[model samples]
Target chain A: MSNKLLECVPNFSEGRNKEVIERIVDPFRKTEGVKLLDYSADKDHNRLVVTVIGDPEGLKKSVLEAMAVAVKEIDMNNHKGEHPRMGAVDVVPFIPVRNVTMEEAVELAKEVARQAAEKFNLPVYLYEDAATSPDRQNLASIRKGQFEGFKEKIKKPEWKPDFGPAEVHPTAGVTAVGARMPLVAFNVNLGTDNIEIADAIARKVRYIGGGLRYCKAIGVDLKERGIVQISMNMTNYTKTSLYQAYELIKVEARRYGVNVVGSELIGILPAQALIDVAVYYLGVENFSEEQILENRLLWG
Target chain B: MSNKLLECVPNFSEGRNKEVIERIVDPFRKTEGVKLLDYSADKDHNRLVVTVIGDPEGLKKSVLEAMAVAVKEIDMNNHKGEHPRMGAVDVVPFIPVRNVTMEEAVELAKEVARQAAEKFNLPVYLYEDAATSPDRQNLASIRKGQFEGFKEKIKKPEWKPDFGPAEVHPTAGVTAVGARMPLVAFNVNLGTDNIEIADAIARKVRYIGGGLRYCKAIGVDLKERGIVQISMNMTNYTKTSLYQAYELIKVEARRYGVNVVGSELIGILPAQALIDVAVYYLGVENFSEEQILENRLLWG
Candidate 1:
């Protein structure tokens, strides 16, 4: 069997203060098993995004250490950010990397939530695939009122925290822990400057409007570039690959005689996604990732 | 910087004797740094192929251990095979995997060749990318004949062994050592049963016939299946991506109204190859392997 691998992307609400951000991320750097691939801080958004990969046990340990620092150093009452926030530590989503089932990832989420609640006396809400109730499955549903509104909402029956006391923490606020698929930010630009046509195509291709499944699409006018775009977030590529989404948008945009200018993948993507597109576009038969020499060189 | 990685494929002359083959391969299995990825024995060809990947040092140690075993157990005079043979331990080709330059690989080949000649008293010839002489750069030129023909060929000034005595070893015989790029066996089957069309298309696509550079193409008739194929081996994928080759063949085959049934990659390929194809086919702008979540996870 292949080796076990998992990805963890954690968001923190103290990006403006460099010392605080580094202090909070210090534990991850010191951790043995987990590797800290990258971390970025945005002053405007007042948020820090950290990317990590490691064995499940090691990742859990590192997250706990980092959270302890966050709880000790960050106070929600003094925090202000453009982005939505409910805790100093904010949101943490665990993604299965290799040889790990989504079910196992959910279990890991629960384990992390339970430990955080017991260790720091903080409230934790399970969202997405780890949700105990159907309503909490969507993170927005759990974070409905943001921090201020959630303070009052927590006292209600449905708004109770999944792993802590119904009462919100004194200053650390609340955290949402979940297991979910990686989200790929993909965008396709049209050669024409027809904003209405781009909007129509985006609406036609998005999931809510009966387009591709697992795709959330929206049209935005690239005013500076004199073009239109179909911005999309592929929440689950396994169900609807990049090629499917691109082709759909291409065909849909062509209805108005608009030609595709180009496409951009906002962030990192899985190797399998690229392979899937290659097979479809190149008409390659019986191609496998194992057929990739570099991949084989990675392991016996 | 990342650790330097290399792939080595060693060919042995004794495939019929399972016990002898196992004994010869034991060193590779036990070596610390070297990873023995695969080994295959062909009775008809009477050859054993062992695939390994590792650091330069790891490969050197493993090769020596395996050579010692081969020297003790096999004799070239008694050897019989459908494939060419000059030694019990026939040929070893080192391929740079990652972060290792071709020059470094050539130096490694020379060191291994010198060690083999000095330690085992086996004559050695360098070929392919590591050849010292322009004429010896090709394997066929160095291996002019099977073991029997090579005995006489070795005495000639032009055909003298690069290392060890002018005479071949009494039992173990001579071994060829060199550094070369990985060869990808790529075959494309035509949807129609037109042998003449396949042959003409193959002629138009191969390097010798002015098709794609770094590509060797031949047309074969799959008589039983009643389909013709354009069989090719891509020596350098960086210069020619899989999709580029497939696209050209598709275009040429179209001249005769031949539809491409499918393409086959005979062995392992580098991840970059597939990534390139995906980028071309999907029109993915500025795509990178690091964007793959799985690849990022592996790095971390």
Candidate 2:
């Protein structure tokens, strides 16, 4: 692990257009030192999310280049999506991957936000760990009414932009830049097709409803698979491990006589999270990362 | 993620002499492109094992340079150790770490063996997947009576050197070079200190006694800890996962009402092995290596 490594997940407003989405993510591939881990465009939400990992210096340069492309190609005023949005390059969150701390990631986010706000004259709101105000800690609060409604909402003394002018950019819109922990999108499917059961279980497991501290969950009907799923976004795996959340769900579902048929980790996850699950389930008393041969090879 | 990565574990005959062991292992660290993953000198065994991983070309050069040092610094004729041995530069195994195949690793082993034999005139024996004869496939069989007895044993046609003259080097002695799958040193300690019960369980679970294939296990007393351990060497983890072995041992130990205290992975292991354990334990229905964030980050 290198102390300089950082993880960045940037959201873009236009996900429906394949060409435009590729163009926006092209900078991550073209840029040196940055590793483009994953990128996906959701058609229904009309949103694109790109996952990138690299050194702080390299990632800062890559995000600027990506923003330059997104600003020119995307017209946020015409953007129509089910998901919330504030800019063409909607939200950029810097995450400390390894050998780096949250505080350092916050500093990196501020540096990136400063550059984007100054160079493009676009308003930037720091959310989560990089928030300038306590009200900015939650992204929903920062982007309460999306771009159109929030455009006028800015100019208020409490809603002034963290960077850029009080006015929102007409076409490009304002962007949210912040630091956050790595988020793991995990879901478990039950044997029964009862969507109600899944919903009740989700309510009991989500943080908003006094469940797992770092989890936000919802139950969805998987029509094609003929099952219901408790889709969850584990915002912080270290605080609430996959095993702890999964066993809780399993135990909760069993009360309704529902058997967990399967589970899915939708996106990239940290190696330690998986190791934690392994150690828990296998009863591997004192297994360390060095016990993993591939890890040893990488360290070597 | 590199296409040409290779891992080499070289064992030398001098562990007691810190200076001699250091001199023998220094070339691996000094060599360009080669990463010295780890090295250990065991006084009880009087042997040094140096682990190196890197580009194939650089690894081969480094191994040869290290062997030159071993040949000049150590003499096997007067060598004394608790562990079995055959030469100053005893055994060198080329392991395919990533983006490499067993056949390619075999080719590499043969090439290194040829160079060692031609340069140092030390007789070489190929074992494991690189063995020419079925009898030679087992390294213990190749080193049957160790260095002292093997000198006279080499006179037979069945013990002919794979790459050198029929005779062993006068001072450095003979060497064994081969290609092998990564071996995981996994052990499960029992809460009780009954060596007899542990031995009985080991026999029932070891491959030779019709247990798991690709698994070699034995029972030993952890005297200082007051526990009996089922020490295991998983020769091929892809075939027999770590959880499978641990589960079997748990079942076998339960007959005598013994519980598992802890387990340990003695050295470096492949990341896939840990991933396999994670998938098994987490009940992750459909997981891919891409789901591991660190793996994806390393891909670039």
Candidate 3:
């Protein structure tokens, strides 16, 4: 069998200090069986996001190493960011990319969370598919109180993490580790500059508005381009595809007499996402990923 | 730079004999850096088609080994098959799958052809992008006389073999070796079984009929299913994408009051072919293959 590939995206609290960000991400570089696809630090959010993929064992080892570095360098007491956070090494989500099942991914995430908690003496909360309780399934719920408020909130019986002590660590507050489906950040730009039109369409097509499930959307202003954009996070492309979101946006925009200028994918996505759309548009029957020559060789 | 991937599909004349087929395909198995994607034999055609992909050097070495096995075991003088053939190890076409340019693939093909000719003392003809002359560019023209007639046909000045002596091998005959773009065997099934409608649409959409430049299409009857198919060999997907053919077929079928039931890809195709169609249908303004996380790791 081919190696099981798992994608890990870990968010660190220190994004302003370039040296600290590099130190946290350094472990993923030049590691055997581990490929560091991308890492970016946002000053405004004061957070660093690192993306890496590889064999399950190799990836777990590299991510642990990076976590150790983050624990040593970052202190949540002094952390300040626009994005919500409950720890120095904030959230680490393990996504199944290829030849891996969700159950296996969940087990891997739990193992990592256990190891991190035991070694670093840092609190680790299991969220998403790997959550210990239904209430903790959402990261926002786990991080409801941010780093400062988490100190008192951790003592609550329901807020107790799946792993680690009831109290937050002195430096690295806490971390959320779990398994989840791959997320696609897709943005659609409208010909008009009216933000209200973009907002209305976002509301009409998003899951919150009883539109498509597995979609989270918001409107943004692209002032320089003189256009309004509906940015979406397609959390589960298998159930709700990119094309589905695009078509819905197009149909919703028609109400306001707005034409879709174009769309863009923000970051990396699994190849299957695009293949699904292609199969739909081309009306191909009985198509398989194995029919892709490159995929065959890669899996082998 | 990453390793350049090249796909080689070689046809051998002895398909009826399982042992001979296995012998010809043995080299591709257990070879480091060389992946044997598929190998199949057709009794009616009396041919074995093997698909392998790897680095240029490794692929060339494996192909030569397979050719030597074919030359020693199969004697084309006594061969009989439905498919046209001029050699024991008939034709080998090198395709650029990733990171390799057409010129590089052509060079690789020539080197392999030269080695095969010198080692086995067999006549080799270069066709497609690696053709030495315009007349030699089409494999059909080189294979016109077949193995039985090649003895006299090869003696002509314009028919001089690109490699080895002008005379064909007593047992193996001649081989056609060259580079070409990946071919997608896409078949579109029509709602109706009217063979004439399928034939007219094929003629209207194929290159010979002043339709798409890179498409070669023919009509086929699927008797058991009670449907007609527009069988096509999309020679260059980069120039004429799968969607272009699919949409054109949909439009053409409408004129005949027939709707397309479904389409199928006969064999392995490059992932780019499907991705291109998805990008077109999605109206993605700036999409890159690198954005595919699995592809990034595979290519790296």
Candidate 1 displacement at residue B267 in angstroms = 1.9
Interface RMSD of 2: 2.1
- Give one digit per residue, the lDDT tens place, for model 1 in B1-300: 137778889898888999989987888788887777778889988889988888888889898888888887888898888898888889989998777899998999999999989999989999889998899887877776878887788888988888888998999888999998878788888988878888898899888898888888888899998899999988888887777778899999888887998877777766777778777766767766677665654443
Q: A25 in model 1: Cα distance from truth in Å?
A: 1.7
| Residue-by-residue lDDT tens digits, candidate 3, B143-257 | 9989999999999999999999999999999999999999999999999989999999999999999889999999999999999999999999999998989899999998998
List per-prediction Cα lDDT, in the order shown. Answer: 0.84, 0.87, 0.91
Pick by lDDT: 2 or 3, better one: 3
Error of 3 at B7 (Å): 0.7
Instruction: Assess every candidate by TM-score.
Output: 0.95, 0.95, 0.96
Ranking by DockQ: 3, 2, 1
Stretches off by above 4 angstroms in model 1 are A297-299, B293-300
- The worst-scoring run of ten residues by lDDT in candidate 1 chain B lies at B291-300
Docking class of 1: medium
| Residue lDDT tens for model 1, A149-233 | 7779999988888898887787888999999987888889899898888889888888889998899888889999999899998
Question: What is candidate 2's lDDT per residue for B1-300, written digit by digit as tens?
Answer: 246787899999999998888788888888887888889999889999998888788888999999999999898888999999999999999998778899999999999999999998889999999999999999899987888887799999999999999987888888999999889888888998899988988898889988999889999999999999999999999898989889998899889999988787777776778778878866777688878776775554
Chain B, candidate 1: TM-score: 0.94
